[model samples]
Target: MATIYDVARLADVSAKTVSRVLNGDGPVGARTREAVQDAMAKLGYVPSNAARTMRSNRSGLVGLITGAITGAQESARPFGLPDLLIVQGIQRVMASRDMTLMIADTGGRADRVPHLVRTFLEHRAEGLIYVAEYHQQIRLPQVPDATPLVLVNCFDDAQSPAVLPDDRQGQHALVRRLVAAGHRRIAYLTLRADMEATPLRTAGYQDALAEAGLPFDPAIVRIGYQSDEEGEMQLLWDAIDDLLRLPEPPTVLCCGNDAMAMRVYGILRSRGVRVPDDMSVAGYDNHRIIAETLYPPLTTVELPYAAMGMKAADRLMSLIAGQGREEPAPTLVTGPVLWRDSVVERRAATLQSISL
Candidate 1:
């Protein structure tokens, strides 16, 4: 392996000059910087991170604790690999930095977190990010006060700085759009009531209804899927059946996530219901694979998965730079509602009620 000294010799510069160029500590002229880079590339010289760490007193390391990749979440989320998008976003932002991300999977066990935290602390990771497979509240094993940490897709009661999806806002926006497109009597089939986002999204749904001067009708709302429960398909199907049997059936079915919407499509079709023509549908968590590939393409709300990850990384970077981790409210990131062919604009919308 070619060393800095070798690079310096090839570039016709002193070792100090080469070190300056490598670290970007003190400025070297643009031409000199270019020459040093060319020489290092020609010699296939790789800079020593350890040496750089020694000089800067920063390991340039960020530790990520996640279970999304391992599918080891508190429970299965309706969203198909949402945390994966978040992790990818974090990677995208950090990729430009001279840092390394060390990941530790909890293997679906929360107890493993402390051990992983200790391992990262031992390695002197400058910062840490904890990502959950779904949006929820969590209590992580204690980390040091000085160590910079950011929570993603989850938050705790302690009000630690976190990057989170604006569940309420996303749901509100999607519902508002549905209302705009002349959907009255929208039936909401939501995730289990226990999930953190459920209540928030429900509130958003109600908000849109109230905004449109519609009454809050709990009778039309039902649990479509449970994160902790199996046989969710039966639960979702029952909800759909219940809605269809209502005296004033909904014109549109809004699902908790794209996966559920996909299932709703099959259920509606099997029951001889034509989507959009008979009943329109909308979902949350615009998982493109499901949303775009669906028969008419789904109209859904996107959770800022990748954007949350990027924001978390940005926050972690700030924290690592000696920015005090003040106990600020969690940063809520919102995503847009994607309009697709799955929804049809009612020509003569009956404000009275919309029925399939």
Candidate 2:
């Protein structure tokens, strides 16, 4: 209940001195600062955040909206949750700046985003970040001119600033590594045909093959995954069967993600196929739980989710600081390829060209 004035009186200093010490707006003598602190501790006084925000003319709040499922709901999507990591990244940067983050989960509903954004604006949030479940495009309602908005893992038709994974580069690097390891006949089991990553990654796959002087064969690449759809086991088996049945069966199978890789592990074992022996496997999104737990740890690429979150926050903060109104260009973050036990060196004996 003790006010700043009371602390000042007790410390034998002017209220202005106390205000300076509390806000750090101006320098106070070391002795004066110590005395002020001593008095505050004795009086059990706490500075009012509301008053500080009012004086500074800032809400000290950053708004974040995500379409992520948490806790029990997380079971619905076991692939790995990058949105959760992205939120953690954003919170880390915000905390360092002495700012508070206000988060809202849409539970996979994009329709609720505009309403949520409006509510944050009403609360005087200085900046806003929108996070999607994956790298995809979205359409958002109009935002005020003064507010700075940034997108994470998604972009909009309005050209809002965005931070996204460099799927092409990541996949390119992975495929190049596979080729270096003597994987001449590599097969890619792709994700949903509609998602942005599917095609970009496919392009990367081709780029590597072209560079390696390896022929690009359409039959080796197949649509292997989809979102919110069942019957994945059938699709995966069909893809695997097609790849292995080819007279020139691939030595390596590249999967869309670690979850798929996990499924592939089971499928290959069921068929009496040995990993890194009869076949080598790789995946994207080095999701540790899925990747590391497999019999032979998975060789995969990082999704750079945390890095994307940091970049988006930095961009939003820059915009808020009056750095020129940047024409929002999508900023891309690259993922590194992780080599692990799931891949084995191809020997000359296993490199024979089989006739179909």
Best by TM-score: 2
Clash count for each candidate, listed in order shown = 0, 0
Q: How much RMSD separates candidate 2 from the native structure?
A: 3.0
**Relative to the unseen true structure, what is the C-alpha lDDT of residue 284 in candidate 1, on a scale of 0 to 100?**
89
Q: lDDT tens string, model 2, 1-356? A: 99999999999999999999999999999999999999999999999877887778788899999866443265555775457888888888988888889998886777888899999998889999998888899998899989999999999888888999999999999999988887889999999999999999999999999999999999999887866436787899899999989999999999999888888999999999999899999999989888888889999999998888888888888888888465548999998999999998874455654421
Write candidate 1's Cα lDDT for 1-356 as tens digits: 99999999999999999999988889799999999999999999998988777777789788999987677344444455457788889998888776788888888889999999999998889999999988888998888988888999899887778988899999999988888888778999998888999999999999999999998889889999855435778898788888899999999999998998998999999999998899999988888989999999999998889899999998988888877567476999999999999998874556445554
Local error of candidate 2 at 18, Å?
3.1
What's the lDDT for residue 133 in model 2?
Answer: 82
User: Model 1 Cα displacement at 303 (Å)?
Assistant: 1.0
Cα-based lDDT for every prediction = 0.87, 0.88
- Provide the lDDT at 276 for model 1: 80
Model 2 bad stretches (over 4 Å):
12-14, 25-31, 69-73, 228-230, 347-356
Clashes in predicted model 1: 0
